[model samples]
Target: MATANADAAEVERLYELGDRLSSAKDKSQHAADYEAIIASVKGQNVKAKQLAAQLIPRYFRSFPALGTFAMEAMFDLVEMEELAIRIQAIRGFPLLGKDAEFISKIADILGQLLTSGTAFLLSFLSSNVKCGYASQVLSCISEENVERDAVHKALMSLIRQDVKNSLQPLFKHVESGSEIREKIICFLRDKVFPVKAELLKPQAEMERYITDLIKKSVQDVTGLEFKLFMDFLRSLSIFGDTAPRESFQELIEIIQAQADLDAQFDVSDIDHIERWTSCIYMALPIFTVWPIQLNNN
Candidate 1:
């Protein structure tokens, strides 16, 4: 094994070597240099790890293939006992995107972290750290013109199979009535637009789930939670076409009841008029179709 030097010259030499190796089209030469550089940096100090991280995005942009191999190797370093090394690895996941197996690799890494007994992985997902990776994956898959249905199905599969109970942890941030609510609302709103009808239409039990979700959202509101409620209402109204007239009537009653109760309680903060307007509009399309059928009969 070639010894790693403690001197700054050795660190710069390795960083520069990695940069050059990134462009080498000869696969064997590239791998040899990449491995040497990774090994050198592992033995070097924290500064070397930071330099390696800074190089990763560029590596990804240039030698995307080599970057994939490097990123996998970095995972071990991130899981290392050294904090600096781990930070470097965290910064390196973006490079993994170039790999065909990136999504599965990321999902597996996140799954392990999420299911681990310790809170480190959960905490990682909380704020800027982990969510970015998820967002990146979403954007990459969506932008690459990967099959929309496949991506949607994959997410639904995870929700249904792996993370059914785990969703509540992610929802806590959404439920906290903070800025994260906006992100959650945007995500769910997008869901409503593209795939909501398809996802909800096949299940006979969808009406019940929809009703329960909307009612729970309304009931869960203690303060001015009207914005998210409106978003949900818009989605429900847009996608609730397959629901029965009874479902529509039940929704109308829920809105009217809420409005009446709010008035009696002097809930000035509540936007009763908007809720009423939404319900009225939501009912119009259904009612119009029904009347046509009735007249034809």
Candidate 2:
């Protein structure tokens, strides 16, 4: 077909542009070249679109200049049949690892990707493909230890702006049976890795901010969310006696609510009994308190 030849020519042109951007020695000049490529791809004739698709990924990891430009161009590429390009975009997050500003910029792109209505972008985020890198990004965000307000805002931004409906995957990480909760606590405490001195240092403003969040969790309706919120509190070593007291009260409330709900149900039913048995067994040691022996008065 004559159309096939046009597609092939378009592909070659995209590849040439990628090569130019990748090898360009001057930073500003290279950026300009990639911008030209962006314009070329955007204005590509129908047959050229197919060619552009094939070059997207190849140019993605080419160089910082090209990589940054490609990332910026992703919003335009989503509608094209450039699955490889989108995949590269997700995978390339690691390249932005060391620079907070660049990482934030890419995070903005990720926010856009989530709402692009493209299944490929969603799958890239929610799928196992990006989990390891995603974890790395999370680790960086936590380590930066900017103020608590800033950290909370960044985390909330990633969840609310980027994850959207894709949040189920992250929520699953904090589920009742998931190991991430324990992992988080262990990492922040002296168990897995010793808490760094810097992390232990106080920021009055940040603590006050976190204290407010702790207080708000008490009014949260979702039991799982409340539990996860508590777990998050336990991970942050800065929480003091006041926060713990509030947390204890919240915990008792949750336990009492569970007791009341269980009492209203017929525990004799096989399925109910099974569920109750698991809950009680799990709660027994976890909820139990042992009386300390003392000298007789």
Candidate 3:
């Protein structure tokens, strides 16, 4: 029941598809072809999924109405257990760049994959590792997760527009858990924290933006997010401290805002205990570099 064209080499197959679409009496009538391609992406075959990844972006122009459907299909591809499949799909992200609305979705995918997603389960970030060496460290530490570099490059490219769209998605994963929290932090530590100022706006502007986000959204953050936000502050203080002396004071204010030093909770409540435990555990890094502004000053 298979057509000779279906099993052709990639280049040949794509050529035939282009001719078919270009020469067709009515392109809309190819809905079945479109559906078949979408179904192939979500199918069980690894190679087929890989092929579909390329096809999704290629056919996107002819089917602008299916951009949502195209993105959904790509989402399914990113989650595949196969590394090649994931990278193949990720490479397609920038192709979708023409559509700004997909930025948030792309951010969510990047954050999840870098965090606890099955595709790229990562080791905890090597702490106190000096700057100028993140790339080597990431490679050595996360060998099986080679996709780290791909995802990082994709993230950096995707953030060029709608930069704030990446914030909520990336921050949502920074919660209290083993692999989830630590690995995502590692991504920020290695990929995000140490970027040269030229990559985006100046570090000072970036710092101010996050500062304002925290000021406006601190109450909305969970215990885990608060803990993560503190870690983010610590990183910014270390690598991009144009606001150094002032940030130390601001850090004190943020801590005070989140703490109820005199308030007590049920001793048996495990969630409360864990949150406090994480708070204390996380603070060790903060205390280690207490008065961070001093070095920068």
Candidate 4:
């Protein structure tokens, strides 16, 4: 009974410290307070660690100037075995990377993490909502210009090394109608497509890679499944004016052929019919505009 009471008191104290950390106004002062928590027995406290993870990003977001210090502190937490702590630590990277001044500092650490933690990060992608955060990190790595070349090289190397093993698991979740699918589509858009023109190898190799991905994703589905495919294709079209025309045309032809067949199918189930109609509706804009855009270009 006495130990239980002591534990309760400890919990309350940690909660109060978390509240103070959250409300901390001065950057140095907040850093000091945060450091104290890390030094305290509460540093290893699970709840305290979770609170620190949540608050560290909030602090960095609110005080961009504190990013370097915050990120340095975060790097320590990234090594923590706890998933919650690791994820929150990972979240802080993209937020810090948004600032150009921080990108160089952030990129090296991110590249290291991506290289060393590829399996862990891939597991996050297989997770439902966590995948969104993971994708955001990849997107930040791809989009930032400061250290882009090195970061992109690291990213692509990791993808090429792990993607074959990774894609099979990802495809299992592809049909779940989760944001994982959308995040992957965006990742491919931002990462893969841009590099096609610059890859040192034969273009067919790159086009074949893209084509295989599309086929794996769209091959088994019809009706509503095509909706995910259409959305993915539309994202691809953002670079339609620049994307490999043959590849884009091939995907469009495949989708158009599927839409045509669905239109003619006997539609006794209204829900199925509605899904098919929606697929066609989604494809219309892509089908109509892509050819015209390609032609005019």
lDDT of each: 0.49, 0.43, 0.63, 0.53
lDDT string, candidate 3, 1-297, tens digits: 244335445435544565676687777767666656767775566667787787677666566677888888888888777778888888888677557777777887776666533333223243424455677565545644567677777887776655567655665554323345555656665776666343336666776775565555554456766765676666663333454455566675566456533458778977667665665565455446455432222
For model 1 the TM-score comes to: 0.38
Per-model TM against the reference: 0.38, 0.41, 0.60, 0.36
Better of 2 and 4 by TM-score: 2
**lDDT score for residue 33 of model 4:** 58
lDDT of 1 by residue, 1-297 (tens): 244445676677766777676667764546555556556545546666666655654455445546556666666555655445554555455445434445445434433332221233344446545445887554434432322232333334443332312233334434455444443444444544355555555344553455455554454443245444544554564336665566555555555554453454434644665555554555466565443222211
State residue 162's C-alpha deviation in candidate 1, in Å.
19
Scanning candidate 3 in windows of ten residues, the lowest lDDT window is 116-125
Candidates ranked, most accurate by TM-score first: 3, 2, 1, 4
RMSD of each: 12.9, 12.9, 9.8, 15.0
- Report the candidate with higher TM-score, 3 versus 4: 3
How do the residues 1-297 of candidate 2 rate in per-residue lDDT, one tens digit apiece? 787777676667767776776676754556555555555556646545444444444444445556656555544654445444434334434343333335555444443343333333345556654557777455434433322223223334333333322233333333433434333222222221122223322545443444343444334223444444555544454433434444444444443443344355774666545544543443343234322222122
List pairs with backbone clashes in candidate 4. Answer: none
Number of clashing pairs per prediction, in order = 0, 0, 0, 0
- Which segments of candidate 3 are over 4 A away from where they belong? 1-6, 9-12, 18-36, 42-45, 59-62, 115-143, 175-179, 199-205, 213-249, 258-260, 264-297
> lDDT of candidate 3?
0.63
Q: What lDDT score is found at residue 83 in candidate 3?
A: 70
